[model samples]
Target: MNGFNWRTLSADELEAQYNPRKSVPDFEQHFTAWVERSASARTRLPGAYDLRYGPGPLQTYDLHKPEGSATGRPLVVLIHGGYWRGLDKNTMTFTAEPFVAAGAVVVNLNYDLCPAVTLDAIVRQMQDALVHIVAKAADWGTSAARLHVIGHSAGAHLAAMMAAAPWAGDLGARPQIASLGLISGVFELEPVLHISPNQEIRLDSAMAVRNSVTRFAPKLAGPVLVAVGDDEPQAWQAQSVDFHQACRDAGTQAHLMRVANANHFNILYALADASKPLCTALLRQCGLK
Candidate 1:
């Protein structure tokens, strides 16, 4: 306990570090903007909506493909983050615009949240979603061989898990992930158990260890691009740095990006802007640039 990062802080103090709303006074503004932009994205882009990857109500994704060529294009899967408790794919639908325009198929995925489902169950659902997408790439007009994944906040943790899984031909005809981008992800879940956000997540010690990307390095063939806001809390930025270092130590290429003048909520918005460094980094990782 004395050596841990949270050792000097009380439980409340620790929770505050992980809670972005506390740090960003105008957090709700971001949500409001996200919803409005998402609605516009859905209407403006040509998409396949309500595609079910599993029988669960939330196990569905909305895929936005390039205007002219939908087939054989690289696929980019975006996972939304709500601390594994709240939010859905619709809030992040706007993210697909830039990637789609760049000729990448972007799929925004949804998963059953915690307090109703365990973290591991959500991870399995994400894996299943990828498998389903890869299995049907030809039908969807995407390429399984060039699949890339992106996740923000809790979704980043899930995306890291997907990148870490041992695909090894077991996916059967679907290629291994080409790369992954984790934007403001929680790499370590142990600290989360002590945070108030953990109530919904309901993570036990073992579950925390199992879900933590920092506990062990993920096996990724391509680079792991981690982006965080410079204005975010130290813990948030540290998560990306530590996870990026862990990936490097494990022989995986990793890069850390600090988005200037952005906070947790706005950093996500930055990812949607093509001119932003974070979005460019992600596109480069996917070989779209």
Candidate 2:
């Protein structure tokens, strides 16, 4: 399937390949688990909540701290995925628990959804949020120089964009990103234009091309992990495989991990477990393991 164009697929085919809900029949159960676990995490974890990084109403983040002093610890930012239109940062706080327990400061970021704002605006919001987080790293008990990011689905796409962003102008200096955990991300936006979610995302061809991460050479110096669930469709899995290749072609170190016995929604369960391979790799990347 190398060099295969998703554009050639029929509308129904694109929908089947890209729409995760279609593949996961019990998707709502996963969301229920995430919300419940996230709530539990919020009650048990010690850190700040609803901290605003921008003027937008949803431009807020929850910072979960490690058990002990966080001085010099790596800061891990978590971005949730809801096809860029659903899901909230609150439901993603569960992902912060294992990272924080592993001695990394974790941040769960929230941004305005599509239709209310363009995909480009959401990307910019993530960049601004990172800048704000990096600027306030000292106050958060973490260093800006040891930042790492992990995002799921659309959030993964945004995380890649952040790694590729030129941060010198925004933060006055480029922050050293230790690693990127991109799980089930769609690096190319062209397929998104065909997906049903495009009704809300409103992505034009030009905008899609402009926002596609695969089209750009990686600017990040750190290693990247492109992960996907083994149960996902061939086209869906190909997204990560192709992006991993793109990163390697750009001379950036990248690894591809095909998660076993998992699908799109449930893959995050692996990410929330410290013992799981996905979480273990991310913790190791943060220098906590």
Against the reference, the lDDT scores of all candidates come to 0.84, 0.87
- The 10-residue segment with the lowest total lDDT in model 1: 166-175
Report the number of backbone clashes for model 2.
0
Residue 206 miss distance in model 1 (angstroms): 0.9
In candidate 2, stretches whose alpha carbon ends up further than 4 angstroms from where it belongs are 166-171
lDDT of 1 by residue, 144-209 (tens): 888999999999999999877544355554347889888888888778877777778899999888
State the lDDT of candidate 2 residue by residue for 133-199, as single tens digits: 9988888788888899999999999999887844546455545677899999988888888888999
Looking at model 2, report the run of 10 residues with the lowest lDDT sum.
165-174
* Model 1 TM-score, 2 decimals: 0.94
**Residue 62 lDDT in model 2?**
88
Q: What lDDT would candidate 1 get against the real structure?
A: 0.84
Deviation from truth (RMSD, Å), model 1: 2.4
Q: Which candidate is the best by TM-score?
A: 2
